[model samples]
Target chain A: MESVLDIKQLTMDFGGLRALDHIDLDVKAGEIAALIGPNGAGKTTFFNCVTGIYKPTEGDMFICPPGKKRERINGLKPNQVTEKGMARTFQNIRLFQNMTVLENVMMGRHCRMRAGIPGAILRNRATREEEQRVVEESYAILKKIGLAEFVNEFAKNLPYGAQRRLEIARAMATEPFLLLLDEPAAGMNNQETKELDELILRIRSEEKISILLIEHDMKLVMSLSDRIFVMDYGRKIAQGTPEEIKNNPAVIKAYLGEDIDA
Target chain B: MNTIKELKKSFLIALWFMFLTFPIMVIKVNTVEQTIDWRWNRLAMVGIFSFFASWIWRYLLQRKEMGQKRAEESETPTLTFQQRVLQNPKFTRPALVVICIFAAIFPFYFSMYQVNIMTTALIYVILGLGLNIVVGLAGLLDLGYVAFYAVGAYSYALLNVHFGMGFWACLPIGAGLAMLFGIVLGFPVLRLRGDYLAIVTLGFGEIIRLILENWNEFSFGPSGIANIPRPGFFGIKMSIHQSLIYIYFIMVAMVIFTIFVVRRLQDSRIGRAWIALREDEVACQATGIDKTKTKLSAFALGATWAGMGGVVFAAKTTFINPASFTIWESIMILCIVVLGGMGSIVGVIFGAGILILLPEYLRAFSEYRMLMFAAALVLMMVFRPHGIISAVRRTYQFEGSPEKKASS
Candidate 1:
């Protein structure tokens, strides 16, 4: 399978502290790859670096859109990275709190839309039609995420689990080829985690997009990810199938400990 | 016990009023002798009246609190008559139409002085709406907004004097210049947030005023550009009365145009991006919104309206000066936006009307007008910080209930 995301020697430093230490990683097309680590393992920092929230100290970050050429996207703006078909959710929920769910989702479609000030102010036929399509497309995505009923509700008003799902729904609206989720199941209950598990699988199969997630939930990481990369202290310790990762002595010592069931 | 509590509240209120009024009431200006005249009787009357007014105010407030408690105990929400009227389109739509009709005929019924005051109030409404886009919708606290108004006024004044441009031609040119200034000012302060943004903008406003004051050759210095041309009625020079009415109509048309444009922008994609940026800049960027572009657009669009207002103001007053575009003017415009609920069009209009007309109507106490204005603003901040009208956020609903649709 062709790799959708290629990261090589990605190094990020904050003065004396090396937040990310020359980590190399990849996610193949339509693959669900999990990056699991202990606290302060720089998993979220890695996501931030790749998504252009932080300018890396040094590295090559390449995104290959399906059936398209591989383009280096290092040092790009966050919005530019998103325009290049990479969307990410924060470890903490970061929805536009005051905006309605539908509005938030529609914002995800912003880069794809081409209406400028003139088009908006004129409300010409083309602008009106384009706006209508944005609404329809955003609503359809909301329905797919089972948030259709709360379309008019403010993002902050939603339940914790629903807000998390709304984030995914919003990211999907970008029509990204690779979706990056940072601890998406952080505060979810078992039922919500189950629903999220199915949702992630469905997203991979139905949307045909690769997913790269940083999660602490070992069960979720083991069950959902096609491949697993274990990290500790900003350094990758092991990379293998979930089965191999579950038994790897270094992975157990660094993160999982002795009990695989736990 | 209740009567005693109410008495205590009234006493405290009366004491506060006495503290506020003592200097103003006790010292009277003797215009004839050019000396201060002690007015013991007037001071005594003021004290007595304040005591009674405080008693009445406390009584009313206590009754309102009691009513609220009773409503809470009932556990059934009931809309007040005012709220019901505001919500029902059948009443509100016709009421608005009637109001508009009356507004249209007001200049004919009122004297020229009253008409001029009304025109001034309308100008403030335009300023309030323009500032609303920056502070309310975009969540950018711009304390230098009056600079744009000054830019527009000076642009038209200079263009008319040098090139003999008509009002129609100068309007767009002035607006464009103001927009350019907005972008220029906005670019440097794009990274600043909150208080820093406000301070920088305030500095920008002062910078513009200082430049206009000292730049003698270009801006005509402190004396200002005088004998500016007035807007014409199709090549006909009318009498003062005819001119007042013409300007009133021009102001009305401009206000309507502003409302229409602002309403359209509020529902557009760009508007959503602005709101998102306001809510969370980081989230906005993460969602693929270019922060610089959005901020610049907000500043430029807001400045555009202020520019139009300045052109009209220059035409109406037939003079332009650095003093007219002071920090006080910016604060007054900001006050209107706050006093009307932020992000509310109708609120800003109502706020402008009250702030502008209240001073005019209180000419008997003209010396105390600014004091009263400051007091009222303080009271507003303490008692009703959201202003007279809080903004009603727009929502989207799936096609279902008519009531939901109407409310949304």
Candidate 2:
């Protein structure tokens, strides 16, 4: 299987403190990979590094958009990383709070669209048609995420689970070859988690995009992720299928007796 | 109970007013002999009037609040007949048409003095709209926007004096120079946020002013460039009144052009990117928005308008001076944007009108003008902080009833 993302010897340091240390991770094309770790395990730090939020102290990161050439994207800005066909959702739900749900998704399509000041001011035929297409495509994404009813509502006004879903909807609008979700199931109830599980599955099958998620929900992790990489203290502890991770001794030790099976 | 509470509030308010007005209002100036006179009677009258005024205002506000609470409790969400009529396109569209017609004919009825005032107010309206693009839409607190206005004026003045360029030719050049300055200023401070950004911009504004003041040969060293050409009508010189009317119409055209452009930008992709950048810059970047490009576009676009305003101002006043582009001008423009409600086109116009016209009408009380303006601003911030016309976030939905299609 061709890998969509490749990270080697990734290390990040905030002055004296090392957040991500010598991590090697990969997510193959169309595979849902899980990066599970205990608190302070540098999962989010790794995501930030790969997404160009932080420049890794030492590492090589490469992204190969399905049919595109593998490109080294070490020090590219976040938008540049996104332009290279990777999109991500934040752990804290960073939707454009003041904008409507549809507008948030439209923002995701910003890089895909091209309309400068003159075009925007003139409202030429091409600009008008492009804008119309953006509206329709954004609405379709909202409908897929079941947020079509609340499309006009502000993103900040949505329920907790809906906000998470809207974040995914926004990310998906970018048409990323690989989607990175930071705790997409965080704070979701059982029913919402079940819905999220199905949504993630549908996203993989229908969109045909790979997903790399940092989730603490074991049941979700076990059922959804095709492959799981366990991390502790900024290093990978184990990598295998869900069943192998469930019985791994090193994973159990790192989780401090919180049974992976339970 | 409510009456007593209102009385107490009114008393405190009256006391505060008395403290503010006693020295300034009670002292009368004798213009002829330069003698100071104290008018105790005037102080008492003002005190008594303020006391009653405060009490009445408090009572009315409380009643309005109670009425609003009752309405909210009912939760019917239906508009009244008046509101429905106001919202109707038939009424509003025609109303807008009428207003535009009135504005077009307004200068013909007014005297030169009134036309001049109207022109000044319109200039501020343009300035307010320009600043709105940066501060309101992009959430960049710029305290140095007057710098761009000065740049435009100086550009026109220099080009006309040195190269003998016409008004029409200088307009674009002036605006382009100002936009260049905006980008130059925006580059280094791209990393700064909030108060820090404001401070840097404020410094940049001062730096421009100081350069103009010190650069004797280029800027004429505070004497300013006088007799700058006024725009002519079809290669013919006109009388003062005719010129005033021409300038008035030109200003009107400029304002309309500005409004049309801004309205279009607000609904477009660039506008959405600005709003997104304002909301969460990190999220914008993650969503594939180039922050540097977005911020630079905002700065440059905003400066473009201010530059045009400066060109018009130079032509109208026929003089260019660093003093005219002072910090106070920037603050006034910022005040107009804030008082109008940030990110609202109509709000900015209304805000500019009130601020400009109120001071003109209060010319009799010129000494107390700024003090009263400051007090009113504080009161406005307390009562309606969002502004006189708080912007309603507009959403664009797909055409032809997507809701119906989805449900079916």
Candidate 3:
């Protein structure tokens, strides 16, 4: 499989704290990769470092856009990283609460808009046409996420699972080649988790986008992830299919051993 | 039946002529002392005439062709609640452009007094845009923004009087001073948010005012600096005797330039960072937007504009004083932002025009002018609490990269 992301010798430190130690991982294109870790195992830190939330203390990061040679990406700002075909959602939902769900999605389209400040302010025809298209595209994305009815509703008002879906939809609106999801199933119960697994599958296949998901839920991760990477003490302990990871001794010592159904 | 009512309205037209004309006919304004009966009677006559005229027009006139050609096409049709607040083309951009052009060109077609009022309105527009940067875009409540205005005025006054500098030279120097003061002020209250920021800014404004009042040796005490130079193009002073078309041009030019800078700043990456900060400060920082730098830059930019405005005002009026840059001035500018719509460039101008210029017409209303203004504000707020222009939905179509761009 073609690699969408390649991280080598990635090290992220918060002063005295090593949030993510020297580690490496790769997510293949058009596949779901679950990053499983115990609490304080730096799953989110790794995610952030990749998405440019925290620039790696030292590392080489590369993104392969399908047929091209893997392009090196390091130390860019989060939005810049997003502009380079990457999008991310926070552990807790970070939708623009006051903005409507559709508007929230439309904000992601900002990277795509060609009309500059003057064009929009002057209300040029191209800007107007662009705005209309954004609205329509946002509406379509909301419908895909099954939140079309709530398109006009403020993001903060959505249900927890719905907000999670909306966050995904918003990130998708950016048309990212890689989606980094931090705890998509956090606070979700069994039913939502089930629906999410189905949604994730549909998105990976239909959008043709690779996903890097941080998940605490063992069953969902084991079942849904095409490749599972286990982390412990800020280091990648093992990476393989769910069956291989299920039996790895280092992975056992790390996150899954305690949580996995025997 | 409605036609008779319409006839009554047309008959009421004579009354409107009486109303609009009678005050000028009965007692010439600017007399300094007018009979009480004349002022009271003129106001009553105008009110009664408008009351009947509107009554007939509502029943008789078609929905589209309303009174006043300007109002006829621009008035928002009555809409359902959601549509009223959340409809496309709520603000017709072209209509606004046309209206702004008319406003910009109006001095050429108006009396000197009207031009004077418009110049004042333009000053307020600048102030409102400045405040919008601090309070609207950056989401930082600044009660002391007017303090920078005072600083700019004082800077210009002190520089021009002592150094014999021209208005053009003093302008940048005044703005630099205001920017310095803004940085000083921003440093103290940088960590604060919401009402705390508001109160701190308010205190700073008052402190500036007090310093100006007490600094007698340099500031000329309560009397103020007078005989300040008015701006001139080459050598032509924008004196009242001059065509006034020239001053109008300057005022229009200032308005245009100020709005352009503000609009540019609002769309840049920094603008998005400011909005992100406004939306959620923690998230903004997490996304690598430096909160301190962003906040301070917003303050500096806002103050720079206010300072520039103060210099022009000092030059335009040919005077400077602590009295002119009062706490009331700060509050009034803040009101214009709220009345117009926070985070909207055009909203601030709309609010400034109504707040500053409308009172000129209500001059005969005397004691009632302020009361009527207050009522009008209340009415506008009741109807559109979000101000006249709200969210500017800026979207990127991505048509260049994709084949699915939607039409506006």
- The sequence of per-residue lDDT tens digits that candidate 1 reaches over residues A1-262 is 8999999999899898998898999999999999988999999899989988999999899989999999999889999999999999989899999788899999999999999988888899999999999998998898889887777777877889999999999899999999999999999999999999999999999999899999999899999999998888988888989999988889878864666575
DockQ versus reference, model 1: 0.46
Model 1, stretches more than 4 Å misplaced?
A256-262, B1-87, B382-384, B399-408
Which ten residues in a row are the worst by lDDT in model 2 chain A? A253-262
**Per-prediction fnat values?**
0.68, 0.77, 0.05
TM-score of candidate 1 to 2 decimals? 0.88
- Local distance difference test, candidate 3: 0.78
lDDT per residue as tens, model 3, A48-87: 8887777789989999977667788897766677777888
Per-prediction DockQ scores? 0.46, 0.58, 0.07
lDDT of 1 by residue, B244-297 (tens): 889999999999999988888877889889888888888789889899999999
Candidate 2 lDDT over A141-183, as tens digits, reads: 9888888877777787677999999999989999999999999
Best by lDDT: 2
Rank ordering of all candidates by TM-score, starting from the highest: 2, 1, 3
Q: What digit string (tens of lDDT, one per residue) describes model 2 on residues B1-408?
A: 477877777777777887799888888889999998998887778778888998776766676577667756652333444446645799989999998999988988888899999999999999999999999999999999999999999898999999998888989998999999999999998998899999999999999999999899989978899999888777898887888888889999999999999999987999999999899989899999999999999999999899999999999999988899889999999999999889888889999999998889778998997898798789778666768776656656555445553663
lDDT of every model, 2 decimals: 0.89, 0.90, 0.78
Better of 2 and 3 by TM-score: 2
Tens-digit lDDT string for candidate 3 (B89-116): 7556666688788976687677887777
Model 3 off-target regions past 4 Å?
A: A123-140, A189-191, A248-262, B1-122, B141-225, B231-274, B281-308, B321-341, B344-408
